[model samples]
Target: MSGGDARQISVRTKDRNSEERSEQLAPPLRRDQSDSITYRSFLRVRAYAVMTKPRVMELLLVTTVPTMILAHGGPPNLPLIVATLMGGAASSGSASAFNMYLDRDMDAQMRRTSGRPLVTGEVAPRSGLLFAWILAVSSTVWFWCLVNYLAAALSVCAILWYVVVYTILLKRRTEQNIVWGGIAGCFPVVIGWASATGTVSWPAVILFLVIFFWTPAHYWPLSVKYGEDYRRVGVPMLGAIHGIEHVAKRVIAYAVATATASLLLIPVAGMSWTYATVAVVGGAWFVGEGLRLQAAARRAEAAARPMRMFVVSNAYLALLFAAVAIDTLVKHRFS
Candidate 1:
């Protein structure tokens, strides 16, 4: 063999090595493709999660576990509590998704709700409705199996009341929408008590009233801030129909009623001193803020920032429920 034949063999060897390197690079490209697919899937799931109205679900769950503890007159079974919360979350999430689906037209008109999954087209309307239905059915089954039939039934009622009674029949037609519509938000207390003791009683009923009365106070100020949004969408929210003075006045009245109703829980539930004190103090603070809102309305102060009451109302309810759990735990430990 000559030098030329040797060089030809060297060139072929280099070509084979290059081919091997190309094959090695292919897996990284495939891995990148896999990663891209996973990220897209994550975004889709996150959009569905948003449709669940997680913030509202968190608040609903906040009221639930404490009621269970108080119902047991102590800390209840941990697993039962966890399972009940999971079912309740699914129920509430389904209701919220249904609301988003039903209200998508109005949601599209309002700046505040314009970014919701349905309104933004992140999830299709049909898909959202199906997701809600699936969750509604599964959550009912979950509660029946994990908690009790009564609790399961209550969960189902909450969904129906919210979707059918509140969203479809009442919202667009009545200024009293939130008044009656808000009842759906009160079911968790009864469900919590029923899950714990397998029945509803005076204590559960009293707590249910507490939340029922608190809803207007909790939600109206936010409505006050977004009155124009409601008006633009033809929603009859209290703030949309009434003047600021009337809305603020209603908030004050409801605040007082909410505080008064909370006190009933003391005698009825045998709630501890800590709960009584927090209820009285938190209720006073809430009512005071409401009074200030009304006074601002009287003064015609455009920049009164009614949203302040909206923020405090959330804190007030959270504090009251926290007091409920702490009081029960304290009594359990000391008594």
Candidate 2:
């Protein structure tokens, strides 16, 4: 072979090697493909969040922080509070995910729940179950290691009560489902108090009972709004089986019970004027909303606005707990 031919071959081989190196250095995906992957990842994360039922978790956490504050007589340890909240949130998420998985069939038939991640096929059933288990185990472990064993045990119990007792056993079986199943929602207050004090106290018990009574009042109005949804799904929520008047009457009884429980906390906790005022005023307003609901039901059942009571119930709880925390903080500051 000639010298030129040898040189040309060497140059071609070097060029080919350099091209391969450049190819290897290039990004695996194009910009559009990377964007697509990122969007999919965001969607997956959102789907998982939806499975956790963030709104319900928000209400649970609302009760938790104030109870912790009241238990500590002020702000609790920041790290402890954060850890407890995180674990509680995870536990709640796990239970809600489990509920979505278990009730996917019913949810598909209900308008209110039709948009859930499970019902909408945003998350696979098996994947959701696995996520639930992961959350349940991880949350329990997180509580055990970061918080205390009492909190951990409570976390586990909350999950089991919500999933097994409420979702599995009661939800499909009776119109009184929420009356019993709502027990799970009240666990946060006790767990919060336990996390702060290491034992449940009278105040905690009273607060728990407050939630116990408040649950039916809070949820029954919502059930009234979604009565048809529950009926279609074969879930015998109170409003589904009972007449609006009957449901409204029950709501009034529970509302009065909730208000009475709130007042009990003032004496039991020795809460100050701030709490006293809020409790009396808030409780009256709450009961009044229930009364309004009942009157509306009596005047024209078709025109009754149960959702008005539902909104009021939420505001009432938030205000009551806020008063609890504020009263503690104010007293602590003055002292």
Candidate 3:
């Protein structure tokens, strides 16, 4: 480069850096502004994080890890596990962010979601949509490079299924939104299994079915609790469309199916006594909670029973997956 041109470029770079430093060193916000720009930036980042739905991703990771262990017949390579989970998080987060963007209108109307980033104006819609697409593409590439092609494809399908199928097509239109739409949530099992073995096996299918059956049992109670919020937003959640009694009945039916599916994993996967015991006992407790909620619904009682059922269902899945991991490790260690 010519000397004059190089000098101009250097001056521009220095000026940019100097401006950044000045901004960093600037005194607290002016008395009129009340809040610093830096603090507002931090909150914007946090709001973006909230758009990812961390709690749902945590439960997804819980299922993914155990399924990977079962697929490997023990704990898999630490680095591979980490890479797969990172990709999974990115995929799920992208789907959630897109859902937030698409549902922001309804979210604004619902009390439960009124404070969501887009709804609250904490994150711009365009930015949220761009973030979602970026994560979606990056996660697919991440899985293909770090895990396997099959895992990557499944991860992409998961995001597509949740965002396109569920969020766009099903959520607002049907009461069975979560029933079939919940299939996206169950893909992590097959993705984890494929990551470990590079193939989907019967064991993985069984676990997938377990999650599929468990979804209604686990989520319907929360739907019952949030029926009014959903109704207010014109979202057709089961508990919003039908009364709590009908929701409770379906919850009991799905609970029974979930319990049966959990037990079937023992025979199909040859899971050990630890898993068997936990599956049976945990399944029973989960169903009992469902029954309690059903009875309350039948009697036209308050919402407490359904809420209790929701809490127990979380514990139920956690314990069952925990037992899967523990049992796999125990047998692998002893053998």
CA RMSD for every model?
A: 6.1, 8.6, 12.5
Candidate 1 residue 65 C-alpha distance from true site, Å: 0.8
Candidate order (lDDT) = 2, 1, 3
Q: Candidate 2 regions off by >4 Å?
A: 1-35
Model 2 Cα lDDT, one tens digit per residue, 90-125: 999999999999999989998888999988888999
lDDT digits (tens) for residues 1-335 of candidate 3: 99999999999999999999999999866554327787778887899899999998977778999999999999999999999999999999999999999999989888889999998888899999999999999999999998999999999889989988999999989988999999998999999999999999998998889889899888888887788999898888987888777887888899889899888888888888999999999989988888887777777657446778888988899999999999999999999
Question: Alpha-carbon error at 26 in model 1, in Å?
Answer: 16
- Per-residue lDDT for 273 in model 2? 93
Weakest lDDT window of 10 consecutive positions for candidate 3: 28-37
Clashing pairs in 1: none
